[model samples]
Target: MLIGHAIFSYFPIIKGWELLVAQFNRIDPEFFWMLAAGFLAQLVDGALGMGYGVISTTILLSTGLNPAAISGSIHTAEMFSSGASGFSHYRFGNVNKKLFRTLLIPGVIGAITGAALLFYLGEKNAGWVRPALSVYTMLLGIRILVNAFRKKTASRKVKNAGWLAGAGGFLDSFGGGGWGPLVTSTLISKGRTPRFVIGTVSLTEFFVTLGSALTFFILLGVSHIETIAGLIIGGVIAAPLAARMAGKLKTRSMMIGVGALVIISSLRALVKFAASFF
Candidate 1:
């Protein structure tokens, strides 16, 4: 099932990875390449609700694209990925409109501000945000993992959890992949109902990513249309299926697995960032 999602949503990303491999015989790239990376990242993102921005932006930046461009494109691609998931949640009546409305404005503001900064960083060779992302995601992953092993667990979706959502959006825009896991986990933690938390998180992902994508295209043009189209197709095909599967998943186990995977990924990223300096 996980492999299915990976294959479905991440086909484009895998394609991009192969290209990088072809060029260098591995995953390493000399610069940013949006088409393959962004598309594939979103595929996995749609399937898993995380890793889209982080992996795509990281790989894209390797392909020689400026930080700004990679950031823009990653943000842009997320719109489609998040939209599909968000719509599904809304359809299922999982969305808490009252809480969502309260959170939307702040979420949007934080995203816009972060996106503006992301563009600037995308143009440079800095890895400043990467480590921060790595650390935060790693910690969240650990926390969830701990929660998963607990015998008596309390998972409630709270109405007053907007601050975490807003903060997660801002950090995700800056650090990457913080949106879904971070916010979803926080909601799960603060005694929010599971159904509403999942729904609210998914819907918020749609809006947050949709807004970011718009900013990217409007501000920075997409040079590779075909690649972008491929990503579009992949996302369209993967989102609904993933949502269906997500609905069937036992939330607790899924959270633990997701948390574990993210932690592994974040550790890898953190190590890489540390290595860069040496």
Candidate 2:
């Protein structure tokens, strides 16, 4: 009580604290909504090894945040969530060390490059770039759905894993989300073990997310602090549970769900963009 009184004696500090509290209170609904979205996205991401960014981006886009801001915010929050998820995946022995190594450097490079491009495109010409990204993500979603039905799996030895990882990382940054949809799906379709692939992807995502987030920070600064906070908190809360659940799930079902989610999100963006024209 004495300490509290002493602190309160500084009127400026007290007022600032009060103002911060008030601002937070005003955004409580939005914060909790973001939190719930983050929780679900991470749960799915952890279980199936993808979709957190895409799901989160869809939610933010629907709220009218610009593409750059949305990507930046999602990447920023993912830095924390991915780290947590990766650790959980590692603990569960879901990671493939070799694959993880092969994917890491290229993925980081791709993510950083893509982040720069996204910011550049956003600044120079945001009008069409966002829609194009939306379309691309939609296509990826379709591909994931197709993979779900294809029974023929390739040899586990992949010559293009690095390239595929690079592509996935690039798209993930450019489209605000695509890493899992592209890389994980491709690897699994090529005969990689679903549990191991999911775990490895989740683990690799930590570095990829960090690079993208840092790039976003350097280019765009911090735009959605509250959203990031919410996502990080909710994602961390769900990470362990999702990691445990990943091994139990069937691959086909996870693919179908991811595909459906991607389609819905991308379609929403496209529709909204089209509506703006008419």
Candidate 3:
């Protein structure tokens, strides 16, 4: 529990030596669970290019963690995880540099705006944010499922970069997940090449996540150090492997996997919320 309290404090700012010491100095059972969550989430996200946020956030929410804090912790840790994923995608020739640049700036802007909104909204009414996010995630999941059955066509260049990336970033920041679900699903459904879309989106996530996390830290202040650290450690371990697997996966399979996960987790969360009203 105390470890949970120490999970997400300015980790990137900490000296490498300090981080190394903290890892060894604070050995707690709870921290290991956090690490495991991170590892599993990152592995899924890496392989499928989505899931870190939905999976991790779902678990934390079920455990009764604060919604804002969970989002904060996820974005903070994602700063590192997305970076690793992006690097792997880049190395594997998955990214389209031109498309990456087009999406990056808008995504960052939307993420920052969304983070600020979430912080303010959550402070005023935390209850609203969690359930709302759960519903939104569920809807996105359903969209993916519909997309999975759609016929593939010849790859075409993506248009409306501003709208798509901005919306994805906003949804991602506000809901604490959705970059892949919203962006990847939509683009792939529109006939964008899966390999490039996954790679570009994965890489752009680093920026979107970084901006959102920074906004959260600025407004909400740092929190959940143990949880964040555990997630970061686990994600780091899994990211490279996930990146390697991304190119190998079929796009339809990836959509099905992501959609199923999102639907299940979101349904569970929503059901819990509905029960709370009863």
For all the candidates, what are their Cα RMSDs to the real structure? 10.0, 5.4, 9.1
Residue 99's C-alpha lDDT in candidate 2?
Answer: 92
TM-scores, each model vs. reference: 0.74, 0.78, 0.79
Error of 1 at 92 (Å): 3.3
User: Where does candidate 2 clash, by residue pair?
Assistant: none
Candidate 2, superposed: residue stretches over 4 Å from native = 1-27, 123-154, 258-278
lDDT per residue for candidate 3 within 140-189, as digits (tens), equals 67877787777855556668987888988987887666677667766765
Tens-digit lDDT string for candidate 1 (165-242): 677777667655577667765665554554566667677787777666666666676764443554455555666665
Candidate 1 wrong stretches, greater than 4 Å = 1-44, 58-66, 120-126, 156-160, 191-195
TM-score of 2: 0.78
lDDT of 2 by residue, 28-114 (tens): 688898899889989989988777976787688777887667777888888998999999999999999999999999999999998
**Candidate 2, residue 189: lDDT:** 55
- Error of model 2, residue 138, in angstroms: 6.5
lDDT of every model, 2 decimals = 0.65, 0.82, 0.79
